[model samples]
Target chain A: MSHDLDWIAADWGSTRLRLWAMAADGTRLAERSSQPERAPRTPAEFETILRALAGDWLERTGTIVACGMLGAREGWVEVPYRPVPCAVTPAALTRAPVAAADTRPTLSLHVVSGLSQATPPDVMRGEETQIAGFLAKNDGWDGVICLPGTHTKWAHVSAGEVVSFQTFMTGELFALLSEQSVLRHGVAEAGWDADAFADALSDTISRPEKLAGKLFALRGGHLLDDLDPATARARLSGLLIGAELAAAKPYWLGQNMALIGSDTVAHPYAEGLAAQGVTVLRADADDMTLAGLRAAHAQLAGA
Target chain B: MSHDLDWIAADWGSTRLRLWAMAADGTRLAERSSQPERAPRTPAEFETILRALAGDWLERTGTIVACGMLGAREGWVEVPYRPVPCAVTPAALTRAPVAAADTRPTLSLHVVSGLSQATPPDVMRGEETQIAGFLAKNDGWDGVICLPGTHTKWAHVSAGEVVSFQTFMTGELFALLSEQSVLRHGVAEAGWDADAFADALSDTISRPEKLAGKLFALRGGHLLDDLDPATARARLSGLLIGAELAAAKPYWLGQNMALIGSDTVAHPYAEGLAAQGVTVLRADADDMTLAGLRAAHAQLAGA
Candidate 1:
């Protein structure tokens, strides 16, 4: 069983680590994860953690390709960001300095560098790998790809390279506002109101500046009109997303667009964009991440 | 000292009750306050709380003029909101039914009703009184009175009546984003950078819709460029306020403006407005609330 594993793919983020045992042909054999008390502070620590998670599968020398925050300056090895207008393939992967004194000769590690745009000064790590996966499938697709999550990103991929990208804190803002702000008092923990969401999305898209005032009205409406908490929650979600869409109009306006995120998270974006008469293709976030890692592995092997 | 007191000017809000012992001519003789565990649920409870705070000032039967959330529907008694395009005086004040069984016949209480806008369906419980106070001092002033706070209000006054007004959740959003959102990690708990504030304010005002994206940059800049927390805090503040100014352009453009809020809270607004070439007069928020309540008392007494 251990011999079936030929390499490893890992997406190590700020808070969690997810690893996949991959065959030489890019087939995933098994998966595992670890909740490190804290992220590794050095290459040795990273090696130790990696060995602990995939040691059994490493019956022979194998290549390990990693992405995500692991490439950040604070990660195991600081990989400089690759300026954009570049392909999202492993050809762009930057190798972190290997531990010269590695005791485990059966392991080789390489971390992928993230993409950065100097003009707008935007940066992305794990999402770049996902974009690579998306482009791998689309092959020469020229348009926009929106990855909605904690920090939703919109990347313009043209001629098989990511031209430019922008990010919005829409998800994080919604979480904080719904859980910590005054709106927390009125927003329900769970439920959906499609009409409320659509109405609020339209209202915010039309007058994004009113966002500041409209937020308070969410609470006031609940108090005065007995607005259902679920509806309030949906409306709040719509408002934040709508504001984002308004700002990101430059990216999605008159372009072929696709959304790469969890079904639940990406549904609203689809609905919102559709309401504006824009068709958006939805793809699974995890699948894209896996495909991205596989594409990186293929490039690394070929190189 | 208590004998000189003629009437009590009270500003009872959601959290605290503030009362000023005033002479018949509006001379503030003394002040007192109380923090009720919960807001009053009935007229009798309101009277009880009022007596506890200023029973000593009521040597003889004296009228009490109250404003703020005490007049809210959930407060002492449901006071109907007086529609806009009217004077912010006792003429719009609604009398809450006095306790007929008051053991102490030395107190008569009247709560001022807040102003509401039907077109936009907005309501204000406390700021109207502040507007009244502002108009009291600046009689015949036909411009904007910006009361900056948790829910900042920009009211247009002409010929002693509030012509129209708008409220922005600028202050509240600033507080929530800086303290609760991911930006909290990068923002300073306390500090200021005037230049950073000015730049961010200008940036957001020019591209208000970019607010969703610019917010994340606060954290990114801190991580990438070693931005000082103090500067980050100020920039965050400027961004939120700048967005507000952009939305409130119609209210302040080519108009004289006065700011009514605490020094710390109002300073940023004054600075932002000043940057836009609008000179704003600043007044103490507490003083304005008092003056507004006093004006209401004068009107009630005349009636």
Candidate 2:
């Protein structure tokens, strides 16, 4: 709880909450944490938890500027989304003026708004703002910036703002298909075969048209005669990833792409896109999000 | 029961069993049925059920020519698979003699051999002989024939034998994806939109690469937002069918494809293929299998 702090920021999602205290120079002075918004805690309970984690600093600092799911309607505090085609600056964030429970109502707080894409209404919760933060840091970047996670975001970025993006339920589908479907019989317990995965990716992308039918080739090639479950499992994985690549190709057209995420999440795709004649720059995820958050906080403080 | 009958023919699968009494001229004189070979009936119990269904005819006919899963290792009787790249014919299906009952050795029987495709080693039980019978009835006809059921088979036919084929695990995947996946969220409890299905087929075939990505769009369009479940379910259904169409395309290139199965099974695909600019001819399942069986029986009889 440093009195000299200029701002506080948080990135909230379905499973985790991260809070940061910053100096005017945007150096993180301290950190706080809590379970995700879905945690079995009421807004008051979560607020107490957040205060317990960083409340002392907040009392001393007298203000905080937070972003992410923590600011959503269902969050510890409700913040409505700012509509699309807006920049991801602190100014772009949707906010709520609130008086904290203190001897004197001293803390002022604001939350960022999620972004949406279409009439079909593809929207992001906390990550949209985080992405906007990333754009804020890397000015003049133009191309696709993929934020891969459970729900992978493939976005087109230009002139320091997210222009357009699509979401692929890749990790979730992989979990469901591999662990739940009858195809579960073919998956390996722990072992991974890079060759098999590459083969599958190639098989899927090369004949994207035949991707689904080829899935059965796993069972067909394994049971009732062909018994190659590993290949089959690999092939299924490939089909999904290949399908993602195909859907993502349009956004990456004629631009340099930066992949910002864990290598485990982004490497295969980088490998896949490389094969497709696309140059991809790989960056560390924590660095990107934190930098973006700092940039957003600094931009807001400056404003 | 016809005293003049020479033998009885049987078809067995995972869930159903069918039998018929035929004269030398292939005139079907009587009908009988029972639970499929997968049922818990012992050899004696199978005989009892068969006799109960057509015992009198068997007594008069004195012989049986049984096929399908009835001959698999796990069935009432084990009939080994005949390797592929060979004519699927009655003579090819001829097996070692088996007594209808240990106590009644006079009742003799022969079982049919199933067919197998190497490389990936896909095998078909019972249906290969039926297909052989079909080829015998319409000798020299070459094209694609679909045997649709819970698992639909699309086989490429040439020179009175199956040249190559691929199976669409469509039916099973549909059941698994709809009933089991998180997709169960917006799916209709039990209704399908034909218009939605038609659109799915078109989109699937047209943008085969987008198949996997579109599935996520189901939950993404609905959960993180609002969506029509029926249309969403239809979209899921279309995504799958589209994938199947993409996989099945290579086999149908520049060929006249005929769907040989029950009307209920073939019609949707017939409509789907029509939309894809492919003309399809339909054939009756019973007649085709009977024609196939009779051809096999006649071939073995001549030998």
Candidate 3:
């Protein structure tokens, strides 16, 4: 069973840890994850999780390349951020230090470095690996790539390098507003209205200053006018994304664009960008993440 | 102790219940509150809290004019909101019903109705009372009364009537971002940087759409540039408030403006307005509440 495995590819974010057992030809032989609910914390936890998922294959594995918050200060090891206006492929993968008394003492564990932008002072972890996967496939393709999540990032790509980028806390704001703020009482727990989203997106895009005022109106609309929960939910998403689009006009206005992810968060950006007359290419986030990890694994052989 | 008391003034909000023993001549004989940390919930709790604060005065009171979310649908009693384009004095104060078997079943309790704007879909619970107080003192003051708080309101007063209004979730957003969002890591629990705030305020106000991006930069700045926590805290506040000011430009651009509250929230609005060349008159929030209650009390005597 371990003969088919060559290296392990992992994407460890704050809320989840995914592991892929890979062959030398970059084919995934097996896949496992600690899902979003029960991700690892300390180095010991990471080791424990890894063994539980791929104990049979790891001892026979030649190398392991992990990406995302696994390299954060609070993670297994602190990997330095590679400042951008640089290549998507990590310049170096630091060997993640483990305890000396570890059972798999000779484990060749390495973590990818995240990217940093100086002027806007933005940083991205897991997304960089996804971007690397994207660049590896597209070669010299140049434009912008948008990866949407809690902390959504918009990167300017040129000549195979992440030239510059910006980030928006849009997803996080939407969650907090819908679940924690006074508006929570008015917005329904589950539902979505595309029309409401389009209207709200157009409203905020035209007048982004009205963002705060519009947020309260959602509650008022629900209480006084009996706004549908679905409408309120979609409008909340629309408003935040609209504000983001308006701000990111410089990045996506007339630029060729690709939106990563097929989830709810990415759907709106697709709709929002399409409304603005942009023909956006959509990519599956999971595939890109795996491809990114595979690209790193293949690079080690050439080096 | 109850001899001088004629009416009882109360301002019951989501987080606090304040009580003021009043004389027929509109004087506040004594004042007390439940404070922000622990407000009342059910009708029984409200009564218990009232007795704890002013047990003696309540027995001799002729009128108990209470204001704020105490009248909310979730409150003890749902005192209907007085739709705007109406006089500052509530159209009516619905008597809050006490349980038949209660200790003071005949208690003359009344909760002031908040104001509602139809077109914009806005509502003000406690700020309406503060506005009434301001109107009572200023006579025919006609302009915008900017009340700063979790849900800050800007009311348009014309000949004592609340012509129309808008609400900004500015303070609430600032709190959410500074204390709960990723930016919380960069911002200190307490501190202010006026210069940093001023710059961010100007930045967002000029380009309101740049808000979501600027927010992420606060965290990024702290990480990359060793940005001061105070600066991050102030910047978070400034960006939110700046977006609000931009939205409220039509209300305060060349109109007579008065800002209610003397605390952290109000200070920034005053400075932001002042920087825009508006000499904003400042007023204490508590003083206005009592005055507003007195105005309501005085009106009761006339009726």
Segments of candidate 3 deviating more than 4 angstroms: A1-3, A35-41, A52-62, B1-3, B35-41, B56-63
Question: What pairs collide in candidate 3?
Answer: none
**Candidate ordering by TM-score (highest first):** 3, 1, 2
Per-residue alpha-carbon lDDT of candidate 2 for residues B1-303, written as tens digits (9 for 90 to 100): 334688778776666778888888889877766764446455665655555666667566656676776665556676666555666644366564445445452555666777666655466776675577667777677887777666677777777767776667676666666676656765765656778778877887878777656765665566556667777766676777766776777766677787777876666677778877889767778777777778777876887
lDDT of each: 0.83, 0.68, 0.84
Q: Write the per-residue lDDT of candidate 3 for residues A117-189, one digit (tens) a residue.
A: 8998988998988888887777777899999999999999998889999999998999899988889988888
Compared to the true structure, candidate 1 yields what TM-score? Answer: 0.82
True contacts kept of each: 0.54, 0.59, 0.77
**lDDT tens string, model 1, B120-238?**
65678888888878778877777889988888888988878888887787777888888877678789999999999999999988888888878878766766677799999999999
DockQ of each: 0.45, 0.35, 0.80
Query: In model 2, which runs have C-alpha deviations exceeding 4 angstroms?
Result: A1-83, A91-113, A119-121, A136-140, A223-232, A284-303, B3-81, B91-113, B126-140, B220-227, B261-265, B284-303
Q: Is candidate 1 or candidate 3 better by lDDT?
A: 3
Q: C-alpha displacement of B120 in model 1, angstroms?
A: 1.7
Higher-ranked by DockQ: 2 or 3: 3
Candidate 1 lDDT over residue span A11-73, tens digit each: 887677888988777787789999899768887788788778877776655578888987877
Q: How far is candidate 1 from the true structure (C-alpha RMSD, Å)?
A: 4.8
